[model samples]
Target: MDPRADSPDDAGTLPHVLVLGGGFGGLWATRALAAAPVRITLVDRTNHHLFQPLLYQVATAGLSAPDVAAPLRHILRKQANATVRLDEVRAIDPHARRVALAQGQLHYDYLVVATGSTHAYFGHDEWAGFAPGLKTLDDALAIRTRVLSAFEAAEREDDPLQRAAWLNFVVIGGGPTGVELAGTLAEIARHTLPREFRRAEVRDARIHLVEAGPRVLAAMPEDLSEKTRQQLQRLGVQVHTGDAVTAIDAEGITLAGRRLASRTVLWAAGVAASPLGSQLGAPTDRAGRVLVAPDLSLPGHPEVLVIGDLASVTQDGKPVPGVAPAAKQMGAHAAAVIRDRLRGVAGEPFRYRDYGNLATIGRMAAVVHFGRLKLSGLLAWWFWLVAHLFFLIGFRNRIIVLTNWAWSYWTYQRHARIIVGRPPPDE
Candidate 1:
C-alpha cells in the first residue's frame, strides 16, 4: 500500500479519526493506522513523543533531552493519513464525537484518548517543592542541576555538617525509575564525582532509596525484588522498606517518625492519569485512569477508545499493568478495531500477551522473568540493554544511547552533565 495515498481525502467522506496526546500510545496508534483509508489528526500539548523509560537517564546526566524525544510533526509528516496538531485537548464530548482543543474543535468518527499521566504527591502537593518528580524533560534537567549542584555545594562548604547535608541524596519510591536513579547516583558519588571534587569526600556521600512497600519493584516477582534490593544495598544505597514518608523539606525527609537530613530528594512514588480522562466524564478508578472495556473502548460510546497510561483495561480479571508494551499493544488493537469496522468485518476482542518484566538494578545486575523463565545478573543486564536499545524511537537515538552507554561503561563517567538554566534569582 502507498503510504501517501490517503492524504488527499479532504472531502470528509472518509472516516476521520482524532488521536489525542503524542506519547507512546498515540504515536503507536498513528503508526498502526498509517496505511488505513482514514484521515488521522494527532493532537498533543507538546510537539514531541517522549521515551519515558529513559527519562531517569536524563535526570542522572547520562542522556540529553533531545536524545529521547522526537518532534511530532517530523515523525508523522511522511504518513499520508496523519496530520500532527500542536494543541492541548481541553475536553471530549463523547455524545457528539467532538474534541475541544485550545484553538478549535475537531469532530471525529473515531476518537482515541491516549493522554498519558502525571506525578501525584497524594494529598500533600506542597511536598513537590522539596521533592521533585521526573516526568518531563524540564523535570529531568532540573533534577540533574539540583543533583550536580549538591556536590558543588559540598565541595565549597567549610562546615562539616553542612557539607554532609549537601552530600546526602534521598530517593523516594523503589520503582524502576527510582532504582535506576538511586543506583546511577550512587555510582556517580562513589566512583565518578570523587575525582572531580576536592576537600569533600564524594565517596562518603549517602544515597537513600526508601519504599513504602515491603520490597522494591513490588510489581515484579519476589525473587527479582529481593535480588534488586540486595544489588542496591551492595552499591552503597541505604534501602528502607515498609516505611512511609511523613514529611519532606529542604533539610531531608521524615520516615517512620525519624528525620533524615539531606539536601537532594527525588520523588518517584505515585502517578495520576491525565486530566483529559476526567474531562470526558468517563468512569475512572482511584488513580484517575479511565476504566475501559475489554477491547479498550468507552462504554456506551463504542466509537471512542481509551488506551495507554490514561486507560485501565483488565486481563484475567485484573487491571493491566501500565507499561510501554501494554500501551503499544492497546494502540495496535485500537487500530485493528478501526480497520475491521471500516471493512465491515467483525474482529476479536483485545487480548494482551505477557512479554515478561525486566529491570536493571545497576551496571552489571538486572532481572528478567518471562513465564517460567527467569534470568538475573549480567545476563539480565545484557537483555535489558538490548531490549531498551531495540525499543527506542529512532536509529539516531539508539546509536546515541549505545555510544553513551559504551563510553560510560568504559570510563565510569557521564557526558551529558552540563547544567543549563540560571539558578533561582535570589528568591
Candidate 2:
C-alpha cells in the first residue's frame, strides 16, 4: 500500500480533489486545478485519455489507437499536485467521504464523478453479442476485426447468397457515430477494398444505415438531415428511417417487417449513464443519469459533483446534450467551484455554452450546425477536419493524425488494419 493513497497529501494539510475517469470532463477539471491549492488524483480503468470524437476513425482503420489516445500520467506529468491511478473505482461512500477501489480505498475532500456512459441495449442486452457498439479502443478494434474478417469470410464462401450476407453491413442509429460508420463502410467497399479481394468483388458490398427516428441527424435542421441522407445515399449507403430494430441474432437483424441478412451489425443508437451514478443514491432519470443541481453537484451532497454523460443537467428548460464540449464546460465549472470554496466565496451556477455541432458523412461530405451559420459539403468537411485536429490533445497526435488523413485521402488505403485478436470463426 502506498502511503500517499491514504489521505490528501503526505503532509495531510491540503484538500484532495479526486476525479473519476480520464475522459474529456475529468481531464479538463484536473488541468483547471493545476494552480489550485489542492491535491488532485485522477483514476481510470485505462491508462490513456481517449479522444472519443474521432474514435470511429480508429474503428474504420483510418487511424491507429495511439493517434487518438494519450496516457493520463503523461498528460499530467507536469502537474506537481496531481496523481494518476490506473484502477477501477468499485464503490463510493459519499456520506463517509471514502471511495472503494478494486485494489484499495482512498479518502478525499472533494469527488468529481465523470465516469461517462456506455452503450444501451434498450432492455435487449442479448443484441450486444451480435451487434457491437463503438465506445473504447477495444470496441473499435473488435469492430475493425469483424468488418475486415467479414470480407475475408466472403472470399472463402462459395455460395453467392452466403457471400452476399458476408458483404452486407448494417449500422443502427442515424446519429453522428452511426452516420460516420455507415458512410465509411461504403467508402471501404467502393474505394478501399475493391482491388484487394480476388474471389469477392467488395464493390458489391451493401451498407445499411437504420434509424428509428424520422431522419438521420434528427438533432440538426430538417433540411440538413435530408442533405445528410442524400449524401449517405450517394456514398452507396442504404438509409432506412422510422424503422426500429425488432430482433437481432448472429446472422442478422429483423427490422419492422423485414429481415436484413448482414454479417456485421454496428450499434450507435443509445447510451445509458454509468452504473456508478445509481450508487450515489441521487435522483436519476430513466437513463440512470443523476439529476444534478444547477452547480452540477448532487442534490444533498455538495461535496460530490457529477458531470459529463453521467449527469443529467437542464438549463433554461433545455437539457444539456451529452457531448464532449458540454462535459468540458461542466468539468471547468467544478474546478471553479472548488477554487471559490477555498477562498470562502460562493460558486456560481454552471451555465453551458453551446458551441454547435459537426458531423462528417464521407470524403468531401459533412454538415456543420453552428447557430445560424450552416455549412455543408466540401467546406464543412475541411472545417470539421480542422476543428478536430485543433481539439485533439498532444502535438504528436495531431501531426500523426493529419499525416494519416492526408495519406488515406490520396491512396484510399487505411494503414492501421492489423488485427490483434483472432476473429470469430465462420459458422
Candidate 3:
C-alpha cells in the first residue's frame, strides 16, 4: 500500500472515504453522507458542478456558463465532514485502496468512483476536430462561437454556395441534446436574428437534426416522438431519421450517400465512460463502464463502489441509462450501503425508481412522459421549466436563468450571443 498522506488529528481517526468527480453522482453521494461518521473527501478536475440538461442552451446562446454551474467548494462549505479537492485521478489500486492523483496519492478506507463519460466517435476520433460535442463549459462556449461565427461568415460571403454552407447547421443525433440544439438553432434563425444581420437572411438558415434510429426520442412513446417531430417541423427544423452519418469532415457530413454542406456540425450521438474506469482493474463494458454488483460495489471489492456514468448497472433485464436521475439515485444508494456497513448490517440491493423522461423542442413546445401521464405543447413546456428551476443548485443561478428565459420569451432575444476566442468575420 502507498504511504498515507499527512492529515489532521481528526482526519486520521475517522474513516477516510474518497469520492471522485463532483458531478451529480459524486455530489449527491457526498451530500447524502453529510451526517455519516466517515470523513468525506470529494475530488474533481473541474471546480464546478455543471447542470448538464441546460448545456445545450449555453451552446445555442440562450444561457451563459455561470447560469448552469456552481463551484464545488461553495456547495460543500457548510458540510463539516467533507473536504473538496480540485485534482484529477490518474490511477486506482483497488487492492491497496489507494488512488493516484495528478498531484499525489491518497489512501482511503472506502472509495466511490463517479467519474462521468465523454463523447464517443465510434472508432472515428478524427471527426472530433470537425464535430464538437457539448460536454463541458468549454465545449459549449466553443460551439457558441462556431455557431455565431457561421452567421458572420455567411454575411460576408459573396458566393452563394459558400454562404449556404455557412448557414447550414447539422446536429448529429436525435437525442435530447440534438433535438434542443436543432430546434433552438431554427428559432434563432427565424425569431432571434432576423433583424440583426443586414447582408445575411438569417431566416434562410437550414437546421437539420440527423438520427440513426427510426425516430427521435426513441425512449418516449411513439405518439410523443411523433409530436416532437411535428413540433420541430413547425420550428423549421428538418428532421432526418434512419440515416446514419457515414463520414464527417471540415466541410460537412455524408448521410444516406448524400453530401451535406455544413460548416457547423455538432455531435450528440454517444458517450463512453471515463478512462479511469479501466484503471480500476475491474470488468468494464465496451463503453469502458465498470460492471458493479447489485449493491453498486465492485464484485470482489465491497469497499470500492462505482456509480453514475462509470457504472454499468441493470434492473429488470434492462441497463440503467446514464442519466442524471439514475446517477443521483446510485449516489444515494452507495451512501446508504456504506452507512449500513458501519452498523454491521448487510447492504440491500440497489433498486432504481423510474421518474419518467422529458425533452423540450422550442418556444413553448416539449414532451413529458410520467407513468401514464403524457403531456406536450405549452403545458409540458411549463412543467419542464418549473422542474429545472426547482433543481438548480443556487438561488442566484435559478433567478438569473428564470429572468433570462422570461426576457427571451417576451422579446425573442438571446443576450448570451457574444462570440469569443475567434476573430470576427469582418476582421
By TM-score, the best candidate is: 2
lDDT of 3: 0.92
lDDT of 3 by residue, 60-179 (tens): 899999999999999999999999988888999999988889878888988999999999999999989889999999999999999999999999999999999999999999999999
1 or 3, greater by TM-score: 3
Per-candidate local distance difference test:
0.87, 0.93, 0.92
Q: Model 2: residues >4 Å from true position, as ranges? A: 1-11, 425-427
What are the clashing pairs of model 1? none
Number of backbone-clashing residue pairs for each candidate, in the order shown: 0, 0, 0
| TM-score of each candidate structure, all chains considered together | 0.95, 0.98, 0.97
Candidate 3, superposed: residue stretches over 4 Å from native = 1-11, 423-427
> Order the candidates by lDDT, highest first — what do you get?
2, 3, 1
TM-score of 1: 0.95
lDDT for residue 199 in candidate 3, whole number 0-100: 90
